[model samples]
Target: MKFNRSFAVLLVPLCLAFGLFALAQDSDDRARPAIMGSTIFDWTLLPVKVSEKGESRRVLRAPTATLDELECHVTTLNPGQEAHPPHQHPDEELIIVKEGTVESLVNGELKIVGPGSVIFQAANQMHSIRNAGDTPATYHVIKWNSPGMLSLKKAAKKMQK
Candidate 1:
């Protein structure tokens, strides 16, 4: 079989592109397996990491069958201490107040709520939480990434680099 020079030139790049795409897909699949079955997280068993602001406990961070990523963590903020500076991200999060009082920055407004209250921080919106009471305020944060959200996040990070 005779191969034209121009045709071969095009075929080489196309093959390379396909190979790269396959590699990328394979890496994504191997990154983390989808979490399955029931699981339990005991509060007392979770190791607490103390910081200047307060304490934190990372519960779970893994991809689920339906979600690209599911992350949960507990935060205990000392009085007048903020979890972090008001910031925004591509993933939405739910904050469930475990105890004490928290002042949450939701869409530029500060809302104060006590234990058992839940706050939803929409994606790409500025949000944060701080201990509003004299004692430490504890809250559980659940964040998730929908399909393709992880790719978008990675692209955004690459742009920032």
Candidate 2:
């Protein structure tokens, strides 16, 4: 076969352009660690266990009204139960399903979620998660409450009750 110099020249710029375009489309992956190793964080490890009303020694309750940024607790839902009775939070929550299946329920509707799955519970909107699977469901829970978020949540909670 005979080679075409003109066709080859045209392809060089096209390949270079593709490479440049791909590099320009990067994502936001910045690291920001507040309390490196403290009980204030949900995703990270804590020094020791703390107790409070509506909380158990093993399971740490939510309502992390700490500050602008707060790490909740790692709630592992075993087979046949909701992480919490259908409830909502004022601040945004990031629920990262680490293992097992998570049946997420929002306002009575059911949503089946599994490992590596996440379901956000919007502030003031009702949401909950349960493990419908046979095994336990583990997840890294992040409940961020910024200043007035807690106050707003308390008011809303009162209204619901």
Candidate 3:
């Protein structure tokens, strides 16, 4: 059987396009399944992971019915220890202080707050948290990515590379 040169050229590009589409679909399938209905993440049951800075309890990292991605975690920052340097991301986040005192960089200012205090970090804004007291500081962080946010993040990462 003989194949036409023009047909071969068209077939090669078509096959490549399908292969790329299949790869994209496979990547999406590998993402964590979305959360549905009521769910409970008991504090006592969650495992704490110790790190050089302190301890952390990861609650969840999955999409919800209304969000592209939802991630929650609790951090225990040891005295005089900072979680990380002030950095910014496209996703906004909320920090709820549970114990001790914490100094958070919010909107370029460092403010100190204790238990029950809430800190909001706006999208693309520089923010960070550190223990400001003699005792360890514990806080719960909740971050979410709205629809299309994940794609934007991927693009930004690609540009950096």
Candidate 4:
């Protein structure tokens, strides 16, 4: 290979530009989260890390910037399993069932939420989702948080007696 100093100099900037372009691709995880049908704002798919093996998995997340700020997740819970832990966060949450039924506990209030069933949870309130039927439970989860007294992760640990 003939080493051309002029050619090498020209290629260096091109390679650097390509590298920067590749890095900018998918800069934010929520930029392309798979949402059901929310085109009024930014919606995309979020890759949730489900460590434990579950029967099913589903999520449609749209994050503005932070994890819970104007975020959304459409989760489907198989019968006899919980999608999320029994914890709380510093954000107000709204869960609405789009299909099937889901059993959830919000601030100690348990209910079998079905289609059109909406539940509003305040910041720092304990919550959990468990499939309470023989079929899959799917819901649209929207979380918007104002400044709360404490983080749900910390509050959950403190409430343990």
lDDT (CA) for every model shown?
Answer: 0.93, 0.65, 0.93, 0.67
lDDT of 1 by residue, 52-146 (tens): 99999999988888888899999999999999999999999999999999999997899999999999999999998999999999999999999
Encode model 3's per-residue lDDT on 52-147: one tens digit a residue: 889999999888888888899999999999999999999999999999999999978999999999999999899999999999999999999999
Which 10 consecutive positions of candidate 3 have the poorest summed lDDT?
Answer: 29-38
Backbone clash count for every predicted candidate, in the order shown: 0, 1, 0, 7
lDDT of 4 at 156: 66
Global Cα RMSD, each model: 3.0, 16.0, 4.0, 11.4
Q: Mark the 10 consecutive residues where model 1 has the least summed lDDT.
A: 29-38
Model 1, which residues run further than 4 Å from truth? 1-27
**lDDT tens readout by residue for model 4, 1-106:** 8989999999999999999887788574446554334454332444454434233333433433334335566676667778778997666778888777778887
User: After superposing candidate 3, which stretches have Cα over 4 Å from the reference?
Assistant: 1-27, 30-32
lDDT of 2 by residue, 66-150 (tens): 5645655666665776757778656778888888888887656898888888777777787877778888777777777676765
CA error at residue 72 for candidate 4, angstroms? 1.0
Candidate structures ordered by lDDT, highest first: 3, 1, 4, 2
